[model samples]
Target chain A: MSLDFLAGFTIFMLALIMVVSMVPGLLAGLESSGIDYDAVAYRTGVILVEDPGWPVYPPWEMNDEVHKDEIERIGLAVSKDTPNILLSTKVETFFNDSFFTPDDYRNLAIFGDIPYSYHFSLRSLDGVTYNEETGDPLPPGYGYIRRVVKIKEPGVAVINGTTFAPQYTSLSSNQEFIVRLDFGQLLDPSVGAAYRIDPRTEPVNVTITNFGAYLNMTEPSTNATLRTVTFWKKDPTRPIPQFTRIPFAYGTTDSSLYTLTIDGNPYDLTPDTKVFDNDNISLVLKPAATSLFTLDQNSILDIRFNFGDTPSQTNITGIHHYDYNSTNVTLPDLQTGVLEVAVW
Target chain B: MVNDAGQLYTMEGVAAGVIMLLTVYIVISTTSIYTPGDTHIPDMQLEQLGSDVLAMMDTPDTNGTKSALETFVNADDDAGFESMFLSYCNAKASGAADDLHMSANVTYRDGNLIKEHQFLAPDNTWTGRESAVRVTRWVQLDSQPGRTTYAGARAQAVLVEVLLWRA
Candidate 1:
């Protein structure tokens, strides 16, 4: 064994040991890829649950197909301050596959470097209100995250004729029932978005039931004709504050914008539907139509229902203020729900 | 062959071999290849879920209304708190509700001593063997003399700590 040969063998052994030690470091980088998937899923979950998304004033959910590129992110939460509290409208818009393509979801919600596949689902505890999902099927191994949330549903103003007949019904020949929405009071800065009623973001539901009490007792008629439903707006900030009729496509029967159902029969805003004594009238004004009206925070919106039956068959005529009064509007409690996200 | 000079080289070779073998053994033993399941993903999920449930419970549904968490703590409604917490935690998107268990403690500063009161007792499923995640929320309470757990006469802030686990 020459000294030169011995030293060469020792150097070879040292090189082999160093290479073996470096093997673990190489494997570590590979193992991190799996963990990275979980990290992406977790980030997507946080974005959907905690964030209110970009372009918040005119919420990202409100963007239509043509303007979809303007949306920077997709989130379900009602507002920035209220995390884990989702808005029903935002949820509906996010899960609408027709409106948003798979690419849109990947770009907005599940932002990842490798174009990772994703699955998102949300179900209300009650099992009826919300059951929505999007994306591809799950594989055997996937990064997953689940968040418990509360769904904030819009309130409905229910005016039972039996309760309001005595106060509103009059002998006046002109019968006009008005439901006033004071945006100043509704969009007050003091009120949080979780509880605030913004017509530009949510639907306005007005239901009047038990019409027998409102029917004129002197007449032998069993029903009254609902001629037209018109919208009027007044801005208090104006030099002379006075309500002017808002011009809209009242003749077009667009259920997407607004829905008017009388006696379980769907009708347009201009429907001259006859309302029976035992029937109910429901008007749902969606946010899409409200946005078309160009209303500001200080604007006052009035939905007037004109009963133009000659020789007036009904006496239902008065302004129904749709304010925060519990008796006028019934705001539902925040419903508990679970939202899950999976990435692979 | 009385060549003592080669002995030093022989000794050096043996020393290098020993060092190399030890390094190989230590690297092989310590460098554990972790499977996806064994990673901290499950812990992160559970911790996030627990934190979300606590946060949602603390938020009020309406602007002026009292949050469910504050109401339960102010009234010392242990049963109500337990049921609410479990309901929120166990709710699922599909299939049967998840099997989740929870135990809670309210920590408040009473004068100089930080007191901890058992707000919710663990159910029978709790065997002390489950991997539980702890989540906490700060709750501000107004002076309520009638409360049994918080006998404080002045307004104070308290921490609601909950240990959550899947049964």
Candidate 2:
């Protein structure tokens, strides 16, 4: 009886010791946490490529530091209808790491319990610009995705005085030159958002070159005194259809709103200065100021160049239609690029 | 005294042995649930790569031109589509190409019926047991006269599905 008890006890003790030693193995298998990295990367890639993100009205790209929380997602696509077509504005804003921290990217772009390291890179096929955001050097194993995409650039209206000088120049004392943007015509539904020239989202550029040709040869002075550049809006739906001056902080030279360059010198849009012959008058109306005007789809916004000199030193008059006419606005061809996302 | 001691020691040993065996069984069953053994990781990666390649092929290099995918689908050029897709899928940033195979089909709605046109048949390497992933893209094509696959006189959206697998 004593011998049988000893054998049974010894067997139980050996089995217990073996089970205790295998506990670490069981924990090792339980902690094999490498299965979900690729799935998370694929999800992140889909979010960035196919979706246009939330808060579409104000645009996620326009959110500043204070309004960063308002951006629910970060997507590179121009709109939902168009996939793999990125907007230059959104691309610029997304890659600006200084504005967004790693936590913001993890929460907004890549949502997961574990904080995964990421690397994103984009380069134009034509070799224009190469952008990269990286957490660390990539390890041997990682989840990666590469997508080819097209970027739609904003259009520019380049008006040369030599081309339109005779057509625009008039004997009228009002030397005001107007660049009219008919929002109804521009935001037409027939034109897809991918190809639309939306002044609400993109900058409106109107450049007047060869100032000599538009100058008043009859005046003794070869220079024109530009009094002020003002913005005007008109609502056709209103009972009275007439142009009304838009109230703005005209005295402030805010580059964020609009930029005026007379002969390559940056100045306020309302600069009262003398512009010489052969000088170029370039005006860029940024999207920030356009949003403030509170204009609707059918509204007409006019950028008027007022030359207030005695006897009118410049003969730049008449309303120039900023339309899709190849002569008026030069729209660049869409550029192709490749974007890669890697997660580890 | 001998009978009492003998029986108690035997019962205690049996109870302890049974408890150790139960703990091992529970630990193994719980641990197996946490480790899924990497079955889905490769599938996810392959699916993403295939989808991305197809999407990129459909995007035109420049505005106002036909994309490579559109051109291939319009002309019913399976060879062109297959070669282009494989090249894109195999391309790497390090300039080395990977080994991947693909087969594709285009699904479109025809009247009240759905029709599928085989775009590319799998090659010799394809077997019945290989783990394959399916990826799809929407291709908008203008109506082509006398084309049975498209089956419409107006512009239509067709889903291009590709099955990708690695050897």
Candidate 3:
């Protein structure tokens, strides 16, 4: 009889406690406002803008007829054409990923729903990138249209094409998860929102480590009397094996350094070498140091050579240079497979 | 009143059981979510655009002073080409297009086209873009057409090789 009485009392106490707990929770649930979360679009990208006017390397060909044809090919007017540089490149990057997650599921939900449209406009050449609308300046080049590229986990992400990452989270669904949105608007049907690097956008610091001109400056040679012999060292990261020691891309400044030895004599490169990594090559220059070539009588000579990301990349800087001295300039022996030597 | 409380508790148990069953059914139906499938779109659209770009590979003729490589690039065709290229980028960037690609390699000599060959494009299986071209302001893109998202093969790529020279 005593055991039964104690059990009943214990049950009564438990029931009373449960009722007390439920009262506050029920009231709170009734009064609580549902989650009002920000949308993924607002948190991910800036508002859409018109064409960013990313740069383009004007088409160029050496032949008059071919050049004319190339102009027609790019759909530009011959007389109105400006010197556009092209940087050819053989770049290979694979997007390899093994992990898929809840966020990926969310993309299936979000990306399909949002209606995205792209617009672009021209920017001034002085690197003044303006938003096509309102005429406001964009973040130097392409601004952050999206916050995250590929989402790795909740509230964290990776930048596409680049390794850098920024803090990000999805405001939609209020789930406090990572957001993945790509805002890199492609060039017009043929271009991307970001700069369109053809053979033109290469580092211009490429030097002819071993370039010797067989001119009247020293002694007349079978090579062009006013002939310029210049050799550019292939960058370690050159895109093509046929061009560089290593078939890969090197850092901008380091690879741009061109070690040029004129007849075994090294010469630091000057801007006038008409050396820009691009598809088109045409420029006249005044020599900085006339070690192997004399600039007195035939001071001006048209020189054309291209050094870039083996396949493409012209605006690159710090190509290898050569050692220039008072005495005879010597050049290192390079495979002259593409070079055709002749004198006028 | 005692009987009423017993029945209330029983109702909650039944409701929870139904929810559990529903959750299992939903998961089974959505399992195909992670696996990607093809859109299988036709090739006519891509081919037309490809031909137009290649056909415009016009350049200037031989002048002792001009670089044949530079001269061969089209002049008036630039705006049109850029428009096309920009649109391509936009479509891919916007994820409205698929990531199909193609390209070609060429060697320039004596202001003339010499050796030319078709190139493989970047794929999910590869690390880098094959037959890619680096342009100004646009960085570099693969020579082959780029990719856009699709449930299946909504896009296709046609390989082409053209030796651009003055006509």
In candidate 3, chain A reaches a TM of 0.19
Per-residue lDDT over B1-167 for candidate 1, one digit per residue giving the tens place of the 0 to 100 score = 67766566656666677777777667656555534444467778889999988888888877688999999988889999988888888888766888888899999987789999998889898999998889999999987665556646778899999998888
Give DockQ for candidates 1 onward, in order.
Answer: 0.38, 0.30, 0.03
What tens digits encode model 1's per-residue C-alpha lDDT throughout A86-118?
Answer: 899999999899998888889999888778888
Candidate 1 positional error at A134, Å: 1.8
Per-prediction TM-score of chain B?
0.77, 0.80, 0.24
lDDT of 2 by residue, B55-138 (tens): 778766544679899999878899999888887777554434679998999998888999998889999999868899999989
Q: Roughly what TM-score does model 2 have, to 2 decimal places?
A: 0.75
Per-model TM against the reference: 0.87, 0.75, 0.20
Predicted model with the maximum DockQ: 1
Preferred candidate (DockQ higher): 1 or 2: 1
Query: In model 3, which regions exceed 4 Å deviation?
Result: A1-86, A89-260, A268-344, B1-8, B19-167
Residue lDDT tens for model 2, A1-344: 77768877887798788888888877666544444566677788778877788777777887778989999998888898888888888888788889889888888888878888987777665445545454556886677767666688889998888799998998774898999999999988877777788888788999999888888877756899888899999999999999999999988888878889998899986789988887889999988889999989999999999998887787789888887676888887666666777787
Candidate 2: docking tier: acceptable
Worst 10 residues of 3 chain B by lDDT: B35-44
Candidate 2 wrong stretches, greater than 4 Å: A1-32, A139-148, A161-167, A171-173, A217-223, A274-278, A309-313, B1-37, B59-66, B75-132, B136-167
Q: How large a fraction of the reference contact set does each model reproduce?
A: 0.50, 0.42, 0.00
Arrange candidates, best lDDT first. 1, 2, 3
Query: Pick by lDDT: which candidate is best?
Result: 1
